[model samples]
Target: MPPAEKTAWDLARAATHANLPLLGTPMSQVVDRLLSARIRQNAFKVRPATRAGVMVSGGGYQGKTETVCEIAAVFEDSWRELHGSHPETVPGSRDLWAPVAYVQTPVTAKPKSTCKAILDFYGAPTKGMDLPELIRQVAASLNDHGTKVLVLDDITRLRMHRADDQDTLDLIRAFMSMHVTLVLVGVDIPGSGLLREGRGRGGKSVNGWEPTQTERRFDLVELDRFRYDTDEQITAWTTHLAGIENALRLLDARPGMLTEGRMPEYLFARTNGVVGLLERLIEDGSTEAIVTGTERLTEPLLDSLPLTLADSVGRDVAAGEVPALPAASRQPGTRPGRRRNTSFDDRGSAASTA
Candidate 1:
């Protein structure tokens, strides 16, 4: 492990690992949803599989949330690059309201959020303070920023009804009308995975949680874990797994860290190979270490895992029988989220919400 990662892990020992489904779960959905929306740009005029789309998957505790946050950092960096003329204190300072895309935080809307409040966060969404003049403001906002992108991260928590696809689609369109791209990240809708039934049907024809489609007018890009990821992505995952194994070895903690065959098998079984779940497993495994301080985790730790994580980690990500590989070094910014995010508690020990 790199000195930095080691340093992070050290800091994470006290009270770093936990499951904040409230926050992490929603955040995960948002990342995939927004990526799907971005992919839409690729399929303009009913184009092929060109609509922008990106997904991160793997078992518990592997770093999916970390990956998403890393992405946010990318947007933040891009925002900084475009406006070398912004404040030094602000993280991504171009008035914030004038963002290239709209990003919804995991804030609860019990109090209700307005279009005005939403636009304001973007810094300068062309529309300024006068939203009643929506058309005019939208036009100006688009002209100033080009197409906007929106991400309602884990939007399901807002007390909104899932039954109404039209309403959902319209609401999405209303936000999209701001000329920015829109991303609806939510928990991976299970079933078929991410299949699209057709237009108006919210693109949900089974096969998983499909984003709702409006008027058969838009595109689709749902993320899935079954697909192959880049070698770099794989490298990041193994590095995390290796770290967990190393941690277990160091502390000599319980049930026994995953053995050769069981490593990936457990990963697949536990987390469906979703990176978040992989991390979660590590987190739990580590916690067991912290608590018992002596017991070997082994397959016993596998028992406490959530279904999604279990299915993924146990079945998919576990590198059964074969020894896992060493991690390849990574460059800053070049590697997104899970790579740089020290977000997990035990050095961001877990992120199990696949």
Candidate 2:
């Protein structure tokens, strides 16, 4: 191919792989159904009462944030469609009419900073405001914007030992009373001190706060990595891979490039069933395939790529646990060659290897 044509083709392939759609898995489906129902119910309620929220907890790279955000975006789209024109702007004023507000909790979150994050989402000024004032403004903004769902990702960042974090947790609970369905996404929330009761002086509860309130107010759900032990799980995993394979745009790609033979098992071993890691591996492998003129995914090609930090840790944890691929599935003379370091090589040498 000509130089210009090759560059264009390479760019197009990169874009296609980068924007691959989120494949539906059993966990995402369940989260959608549950979160959708809760949001719908909260939106319809006219009476003043605390809305029950959902807490999506899981390990890193389990797609917790992506899944919840997709559901929230879908809800917002349908809501605007149902409300007809001028859905983004209020009828008589320039106020924003947002049905969903998504924000991330600050890494070193305190009660004041947490409230500031919410205010920042609405483009509201929080300067010179104290904690109480910040809280009042946040509530007002939620009402003014007509927000029905508020998503706070990375909720476990709040360390409950500090008084500020304790108050932040309380502030989050207070937001539930504002009639917005709260969707808290975090890693291992149950293990986080957010749910544990604080010990008070003389063994009494601090300020008579009820720790079970969190458990009762929010429906905690977990998103786990895909498992291969059961037949149903195997089907789900392979189906997911097939969806990805179908979306790929390589010139020489063949059907079952990811799902047939030992590829599925090999991929499972590499990613440990984490969707994010699997996508990374596929994307990097595909880019290498295009650069090297192979134009198709293969075991050796994927194996040549390096693992992310998360994947490396997961591999260490699952060492000797993942089942080994059968001997018959291995190709007789195929092995992954070492990736050549071309950063220090001249253009001619790099082109020669390519």
Candidate 3:
């Protein structure tokens, strides 16, 4: 084979292998065991209206994006892994055989956060020239496929960084009406009046919040914070977190500085166990380390991380910033912030978080 051809083949093979068992999507054991079955069931039950949803609630980090992307990659790459790779030139229409997964994250920094804004993403017919039409075009175009997974990241963005359980729930229901497999990620605790909607208009079954169709074709998967004290699990979710940062850093740029021979122990120590914060911390750490020589990741460098991270970490751990946190728990440079999510150290996996 030509050298370039050989390289492409090798790269494709590597991509296929890394996604085996698809480690990215955070799934409950029940969902994991029945993904294929559930997909098939929904495929048959709802042609224009299938609906399965998962709501992962935790601090802003915890591998949520990693988890979701992995699942998307799984659906995207499964074909090549199962069938031999065709030339990249194959038209996405004629040669495309794998299930196409459409991703629509309507959560943006825009000021309009209304049902019209969201329904637009769902592809509902919109005649007016506005955000709603853009969303509608996106939703319809993406959902046109036979089998697809639509992921809306940070759905809570609609409520301005506040958790609106009703908005979340309503959006999920709306997406269900569209017959799409959905995954929604956001923080816990409702910041909007969405919770009021979920309570149902009195005397209605909570689960009765189903589609108006003849059948129910979806399941619920809830992602929770890793329980720290499970009998089988350890309390130091920090260790697991340390490994995550170390791996990302090692795989990321500046490999030698952070991983060279050892691990990012400080990376783990500082962020505790929040994946979002840990990622930001590591990213900030790597950027600084790369530019600075990183003699060793120190308290001073960590303190200089971006404001988003600083604010995020601060909100999690400070009860009033009483005593300065010990090195093991404190991210450097900054004063004590808010208390963090309790760490989970047991042999606990994401599945255990439920």
Candidate 4:
């Protein structure tokens, strides 16, 4: 092989060893847009009070975390390139300038704890401070360092009606009050009362009126699984397959035979168009081939991989389900395109055979 091909092959082999985030379209573009908007806002001499934040709500395994993390990585890289490798800090202050500050909401979702988490992210002292004091400290620190955006993940876990939930809401309000643009990412929490449409009729707030003031400040972005019933869905699947095929070629491995073949119909059907599930199927299938020294993907290999068919039975389905159609009753050796009545249940997986 040529030296370039040899290098590509080596990199591809290494890629298979790790489960890395795949750069897909809408996901990458949205992250870039959010970051760019934040950067543009940062350039403003006076921060706009009406600057809207973004809320990305999706079901689990939709790459919410991965997408946000990717944004964080990109921001850090861009910041490092603009500033030197060593970030310039505030005069006589220990705070390091950060382009982005990412924190996961605590399980309790208490305002104090969540505030403390923000302070902790900024390396600020969080001991023995009242809620108001802590909030002030955190907001001040973020402003001091000029952090572009604050990303909070798992916002769905905030329990409504609980004092902690109110606290979480307060913490968020404090961030907004400080002119910090928030990038909230979490499972979809519809009718959570904490949010209200800008033009909503009547007074509809999730839990109470406390969140009413902050409710209209969000730009909502909801992500759903891809579909196979339409041309658009097929294009998404095919485009993703092209990316995977390119990856396989880099490994000098045989291209994805399953993707190249009719198996994508089966794949789209099984995974229900969830990017995460598709990624898992590809990752597991690729890793298996590499382990077994196959160096190529096949239908049987792709089919044999135990995939996460559905969720863990909150809405309806069981955890162990393989999520595929019962074998077609068509005569053997007769290939017929089949679309079953089975729909993608966003609730959870069902216990069914592959």
Ranking by TM-score: 2, 4, 3, 1
lDDT by residue for model 3 (248-340), tens:
422224434443232334443455434455555655565565456552455567767642534444222321111122244444322223343
Q: Rank the candidates by lDDT, best first.
A: 2, 4, 3, 1
Q: Which parts of model 1 have CA positions greater than 4 angstroms off?
A: 1-12, 15-69, 86-148, 155-168, 187-219, 226-240, 243-249, 253-259, 301-354
Could you give the C-alpha RMSD of every candidate to the true structure, in order shown?
15.4, 11.6, 12.5, 9.4
Please write out the lDDT profile of model 1 over residues 1-354, one tens digit for every residue.
797985676456634455322223333465546653453443232322212323332322444434455555466466556666433234443333434354443333321233443455445443334435644554455435433344444433323333343243344455544435454444432221222322322424453544543313344333334211466544444544555555443255433355343454445445544555455566766666556644455555546533333334222222121113212222323332233334653664577889
The TM-score of predicted model 3 comes to 0.50
| Colliding pairs, model 4 | 192-206, 193-205, 193-206, 194-206, 310-349, 311-348, 311-349, 318-349
- Writing each residue's lDDT as its tens digit, candidate 2 over 122-163 gives 999999999889999999899888899999988877766788
lDDT of 4 by residue, 264-322 (tens): 66666546667777777777777787667676766677767767544544321121112
lDDT of each: 0.42, 0.80, 0.44, 0.64
Q: What is the lDDT of residue 80 in candidate 4?
A: 72
Better candidate number, 1 or 4, judged by lDDT: 4
